[model samples]
Target chain A: MADKIFRVNMADLTTSIEDIPADWAGHGGRGLTSTIVSAEVEPTCHPLGQNNKLVFAPGLLSGTAAANSGRLSIGAKSPLTGTIKESNSGGTAAQLFAKAGCKALIVEGLPKADNWYSLALTPDGVTITEEKELIGQGNFAVVQALENRIEGKHGLLSIGQAGEMRLASANISIKDPDGSLRSCGRGGLGAVMGAKKIKFITVDPKDGKVAIAKPDAFKDANRIFAKALVDHPVSQALGQYGTNVLTNIINESGGFPTQNFTKGQFEGHESISGETMHDTIKERGGKVKHGCHQGCVIQCSQIYNDADGKKLTAGFEYESIWAMGADCCVDNLDHIAEADRIMDDIGIDTIETSVAMGVAMEAGVLPFGDGAGICKLLTEDITKGTGIGRIIGNGAGSVGRAFGITRVPVVKNQAIPAYDPRAIKGIGITYATSTQGADHTMGYTIATNILNVGGKVDPLTKEGQVELSRNLQIATAAIDSTGMCLFIAFAALDDEKCLPALVDLLNARFDLSLTGDDVVSLGQHILKTERAFNTAAGFTSADDRLPEFFYNEPLPPHNVVFDFSGEEIDTFWDF
Target chain B: MKISVKLFAYFRDNRFKIKEYDIDEGTTVGNIVDDLNIDREEVGVLMINSRHTNFDVHPVEKDILAIFPVIGGG
Candidate 1:
């Protein structure tokens, strides 16, 4: 069966299934979602309004026995950044979504009533149910209730009170195979979902019965791909240490973005470093090197445990550690872990909220390095929707505006992640020009600039940074559309055979003739569609810029500022 | 002369996270890494007193030198 698009319009509670448009057959994941949003939705409409749409799409190779190819991309006109957002994640939902033969699932329009609803997808069709019983619960409870409540073996995607309240930093939580939650956690698409009154989404596992076009060819390509992934030293290290391995290294490199971007290094960074976190996790009998989703070879995710050896969090990332630990000046690893768990349960983007905490700290709403106080702010104040909580929940930009804080590290109203752009010039271009706001995943130049995964580019120099960022952004857009985990890039960049193998996998899956150049075209096409949409939404080249403070404030360690001019950053769009 | 040396990420797996190293005042970062037995090819980034430095950079007295292996997540 040809994959079909399932459209749900909340205005009158209607649904329609349509065949995949010929033009859209080649696109999936970010490419598909961005294409649909750019073509179907009004770009200038308010993000949470009826005219805006939220789209979920599995990658082209999803659910087809492709290793590490279970990524799901969620696209929308972002409530947080007010730009085009394509936030992707690894979880069971993408596999199931594709297995059910869905090219894309689009949620459009606003519900007429104030009540909430839920949708369950079976191989046969989609069923919408009015569910008020589980409205205010967190993601953990939502996933738990659905098993007994809905009677199905399926993957779950849900939101928490943060989403229900339409917080700008809200994210949609997806249940992993182990019943732990992962997130499509950027750009506030959760707010759009909430505005449409979707409490949760479940796709039944039996619905997935996908067949690869050329089984033997796919098998051979996948074998080569998996070998490349596991053989790479970086992939092996990630499988062992998880992403938190970056904490100490980034901090030591003098680009950790500490204390709301006041400095690049944190005095208390060592306390929350990956080494310390790993030691504590080991002592607590926690499992490291776990995968957030099934079929992932490089398992950078871990199941962090508390003192009692109980589950604390999964997928505890380096950026979150930086945002909650160093950026906010709270270094107690346990406190940071608890905060990470809470952020997950509450369905907020960890990076945005952590940066919001930094903004709040700068406002004197909460003091920096106050571990207990930060927890209280999240649990007591933010959860209950107090005035301060609401402001912070609105995201870093709102918090900075409310408090008159000028040093906020945000571009296009979305907070930057762990890396200090002033210290690493290449990422500055990415943060400045990314259509999704200050998003690192949009163009992870760190691979080349810092990690030397692709090629070495001087982190402190302006030369090659723009070119590096542009190439990475294009490559990333293509990767996000492929349904494979981004970590594959570590292998693909280093081993020349890795990318061709991935292309072969896709070609085998679809029975087509695709080359490395075709992959590049796919990437370039997605970026162009997204940029055109952003431009239609009133994003001038002027909007593609870092914050003024990034230019004025010199981060210590390097004492360097984001020195790229508007003309230089604008060159990213020349593609 | 003594310079404060820090090891980051896997560089500290079996080694020290940080320590006071007794090196000559003009000792280069490459010399210190060699003394610590960290592979030169394995080092991704290097810094001195919070500023980015290369292996050829010789630390002054009281300098805080840090060595990091390749690491990227975000």
Candidate 2:
């Protein structure tokens, strides 16, 4: 297969092709997107403005038959967090993209008219076609329409009404192999696409393959990587119970982030626990341990169905459950599932919406634990983009601002995920300082603090957690760039061969001579690039700091406050 | 001595989610896991009085010992 670049100038609605530049040859997925944005885009430009460009690239091994290598990265200036952002997902689009011999797709400039368009990538080139029919449709309806229009097997990436209205927390939804959708869910990249007036991008490759430099070496490495994933207990657990398994564990640990961060434990946790969900799925004849994309041996995703055996949602992840359930005090899993479906259809970040729901409830907009109320809010209010709906769609930070509430648990204006910072103090440090706002995958010190996979870092010990978080963040940045699922970290931390196997895979694919040290350097370079961009965009250490409320209000279980001083948080930038 | 024990994730399988038992105050957290037939290797995090500790850590009066299997997500 051949490899080239597809650049779309949205200003004039023109498309062009260029050779894959030598400098960008080593990078892919998050790496390439960050590099390109740093080099080409203005850091200080308004995220919804013409100067901001949205870039999409497949992972390093995406097009190939590498296990768990189908995650696609979309990067741009975040309207939600005002930071350089890279959001990822697993879907059919990445594989088709890689197979088409396309290295990266960059959409730049802005359309003069307020018209929507869609791009189709075929064997020869990309075509920018204007579309009026698909403008206001939900993601599911849009995908069905696209499939009907194309009349063949293809991959899709489309946004919903939230994106069309340019909400700050809108996400880009990617079509999975099963015609279900997975999302690049964070940082409002969908709004960036909306600003460009692109409705969706379709990839229907006639025939193409990944350009492999050493197929034999890649195959050998693949065998090792695949085995490592299959042989891991964590992977097995994820396959069986899925990520929602954390409900009981985190609740038992007394760090569940209940009722909008007011408490750490949920009394109704058992109702929405993974074990309960697993039993319900089995009774309802839903498929469990399903892969969202090809070559995923772990299969942590699942298809959740209603009592009538009708599909409700796929890949009902832990963060979504936690945000929609415990954080909002909604114990009804079915209601949460419906909320998930609506969020998927509307193209909004679930974590942000969950936090916004909590804020809305706290502001007397709706009572907490009102499942029906939440469903109505999501369907009738948020989906239609009403006045108050606009605030919720914008994200937790905006909801808090609208209601004048101070307890919003957000960093860089992005809502924090499941874990409670006060319970795990290291997470507080991470939430306060991560380059991408309150993101756990950025560093995920939980591997050591909770799982004890890498090494023991006492969760309550400030010094150790800081050092542990720093090292993990560096390693994580590198892993995210490779298009590998972050779950590989469990195997990588335990089995010494895991990281080497991944490096070997990359080296074989690209014919590059890279060492373990190079990976570390690459991670550092990427973080530094992002940090520099945020700095130039007028972000200060003050923006990096968590709100003052976390310091004053001690969370239960540990009853520990977020005591990390400004100095400790600033140390995260030392690299 | 009265002490409380909480198990998390897969450890809850065939085990109570939270149970209280009367035992010697000097009992090690390792003894409790072993007594419950939980493999030391299977136990990921050990918290004594809500602080991180190892298997060798001995409990004091009213100490809440929480045992978590390798529960990893997000």
Candidate 3:
């Protein structure tokens, strides 16, 4: 069966499988979600209201035997950033959705009844059922309970207490192969799901398979693609240390965003460094390397354990460590791990919530370096939905507004991640011009600016920053569409065999003659479509800017402020 | 001349995390990497006093030099 658009109306409790629209036939993942939202969703609709539709899509190569193609893109009007949002994650859901012949799943309209529901999708269609037992539970409990409640192997996506409270920092948690959670961890799409009163959505392919137009050609391309990914030195490093390897590298670059973006380096960076984390994990008998999805060649995820060797968290990423560790001045790895586990269970974006905590700390709600205090706040406040918890749960911008702090680090109301853009000017442009707000993954200029992967661009200079960000943002949009892991870009940029093999994978799967230029065109089209939606939604160039502090308070060590004039930043859109 | 050296990731596997080194005044970053038995290609980033530098650059006294393997992640 050709993949179909699955639509569920919460207001009327109706489900329908519609034929794939002609315009959407070639699109997948972020491209499809953005295209669908632009076509169907009203630009001015309240993000958490009935008019905002939530769309889930697997990439074009997803569910195929392609390496690193198991990413699922979830899109909606963000209650957090208030821009058209697409946050993707790794889990079984993408592969399952693709195998089930679901090109995209669209959930729209508000539920009139004041009750929670769940959607169960099979190869046949979707069924809506009333959910009662696990309504207010955290994501961990929900997954455990569903494991017994549902029979057979299935994929789940759920939201927890934060989502139930409709917090702006809430994220949709997707179940990994081991039943642990991986989050679509930005832009508060979970609040959209919660507003529609969905507790979880499960996908069971039931032996269904994604059809390929040229199987032999696809197998050959996938072989070359996987080799390119595996042969890269960066991939080897990521497999060894996970993404946390960047902690020390970024810290050394003096762009680690320490202590609420006030400084660039942390005095206690050694304790929470990836090197320390790796040795600690080895000592505690935790798995040093793990994959979130089945086809992942680069297993950047890991199972971190507490002192007693009990599992504390998995998929402990650099951004989360930076937010909770350096950005908050918490030195202890175990404390950061505990808080990480809590955030995962709560189904909240760790970057948003922890950065919010940093702002709250600056407001004197708690002293800095209080890791236990951070855990206490998450448990007793955020999870319980206390008034102060709501302030933090709404994200860094909300916390800043509540405390009257002028040095808050947010762009378009979304908290900036680990990088301090004042030192690395390329990323600063990306943070400013990104349609999804201050997201590192949207462009990831760090690869070239700091790591020298694609090529060297002077990090401290403003000369080539705008052009670099524009090119990266465009490529990233296209990469996100294929559902390939963003890490593939390291090899794609440097390895001669990488990108062509990727394009070959797409061509072989769909039987289309897409050249490299076609891929670039796809990327540009996706960005323009997303930008057009944000434009229609009342965003001006002024919205595409970093906070004033980035330009005023020069970061330490470098003693440099983000000096890009608005005109320089506006040039990012020239492409 | 006295300088501090900070090594991270696999560079610290058989070596110290941060150590103080006393060297000749004109010692470049390459000289230190050679002394530490670290391959030039293996060095992903070299920072002197928290700023990006290369193997050819001479570090001043009291500089804090950090070395990392060819690692990249977001």
Candidate 4:
């Protein structure tokens, strides 16, 4: 392994390479990113301050051709929620970083100039280029410009105007195949990038291949994992239907957030469901499923098309559907598709943008289902940075506050995802206490063997939710550190051998023998470390909770309220 | 009494579309599972009146039941 760290100091436009920590070899990717951010960056520093650092690391199995293993984690203190944040994305960047023979990239210090610039990493070294010409360009345009300029095949991570303005809901876009925009679109990390005066980071690996320490064992483990994923029903559904498959299921369960979360079920879920998307793709002759990266076997991503069979977007996942569909009271799939394309181009968080629009409609700023009005508001008015556009850019919490809507569904200033916690109480717990606020990936309980951490509790029962959330959070932290996609949890839960096999593969590759228990312990430790950072940053148990509206309003279909007591919720992490 | 048994998604596509099963008084969800010839392990979420319920939970008369396979992802 190359024992080197690539460091970029924007203050002096200086770059250097240093030896990697001897202990960091086994802990590449998310493990390395989280550890470096937590240790090196001050927990209490302003998210956009010079004291903050953005660290990117690929996973332990990132370089190897492990299925769905090419994941890159961008970790720093989040501007949106003011918490420790790590957002993992899949594209070509992780694989490129691995091939570049570097474990991680640490971007430190704010730029001395007030102009836009970008850092390009290649086999030769790093170059700082003036990106002022690239300013005001959308994510796709910026990506194309960077690709053209870099003179080879490259992966570009760039932010749009939302990030430039330091909008709390800003996201960083990564290029997918056929040049569609996929993003790390949660937790305002793009604002942090904006603060650094860095418009984009382009990584190219002209070097032939990423060396693997144990190729045979890695291949065997990867094959087993691939087979398990292919055989799993959830994986099959995801591959076939994309994430929109959950639209009907969540609506049926009364957990699909609708009309700014005033109701749990949307009356028109079928119009925007996975089935509809699948049919649309078929009719339009679009690709139903494709990989986000080269070696991904799950292939849950899809190339969405217009009614006329023209390409509209790629990777139109469930959250985007929920945001534009039920949440905003727009059931027109084509309108939702257009909104998704706009979000991708603008480099913004779809969930936050949808929730903000919902709140705006509630405030009578625009009528519900006003897709054209929303399009104008986001694309045309937002660049002016005045009037309602400013409030919309601030995220769901800020918009809710501006509109005096107490029913705003958020935790730590970040809007909640598609799952309404009242209906799916297990996921609610995860949203409240997650290191990154209100995130579903923090603790995915979809297919896990419901660990009897609390008891056999009903989804509507509030009694055991805290403990459930806590347990899942710990498990998810460990999973994220592996640099593995959280979707693996579906197969890993039922196939008990998968987790052990993963650990075994890591151990063999890193020359260590780690037991399954040790893996669990590592997860716990990562959470504890994150929690300590949050605590020191002035987060109390009170901060670990869903918004107040959830406690009073009863969600539909089941009509259950979030009934967990404050004490029970507070005591959740005692374990 | 008879209750309607409906399977969705892969189950509907793969197995019998829909069927009416003659059930006894005080019949529970577990009994329905046994009667349908579906693997109990395959059922991840069971709903009656649009609320999630476990296998051991008893079904009420005239209850509209929907069974979903253990399918979930983000």
TM-score of chain B in each prediction: 0.92, 0.92, 0.96, 0.77
Q: Determine which window of 10 residues in candidate 2 chain A has minimal summed lDDT.
A: A456-465
**What DockQ, between 0 and 1, does each candidate earn?**
0.51, 0.52, 0.80, 0.39
Error of 4 at A91 (Å): 0.9
Put down candidate 4 lDDT per residue, A234-301, tens digits, no spaces.
Answer: 78878888877778777877888899888888988878988778879989988999888887777889
lDDT (Cα, tens digit) per residue for candidate 3, span B1-74: 89999998888878998899999978999999999999998888888877778999998889999998878898
- Tens digit of lDDT per residue, candidate 1, span A491-564? 88889889999999999999999999999988988889998999998989999888898899898877888888
lDDT: the better of candidates 1 and 4: 1
Docking model 2 quality class: medium
> Best TM-score goes to which candidate?
3
**Which regions of candidate 2 deviate over 4 angstroms?**
B1-4, B20-26, B59-64
Question: Where does candidate 3 chain A have its weakest 10-residue lDDT segment?
Answer: A268-277
lDDT of 3 at A430: 94
TM-scores of the candidates in the order shown: 0.96, 0.97, 0.99, 0.93
TM-score of chain A of each: 0.99, 0.99, 1.00, 0.96
Clashing pairs in 1: A557-B50
User: What lDDT is obtained when candidate 1 is compared to the true structure?
Assistant: 0.87
Worst 10 residues of 4 chain A by lDDT: A446-455
Which scores higher on lDDT, 3 or 4? 3
Tens digits of per-residue lDDT for model 3, A426-506:
999999999999999999999988898898887888889899999999999999999999999999999999999999999
Please state the Cα-based DockQ of model 1 relative to the true two-chain complex.
0.51
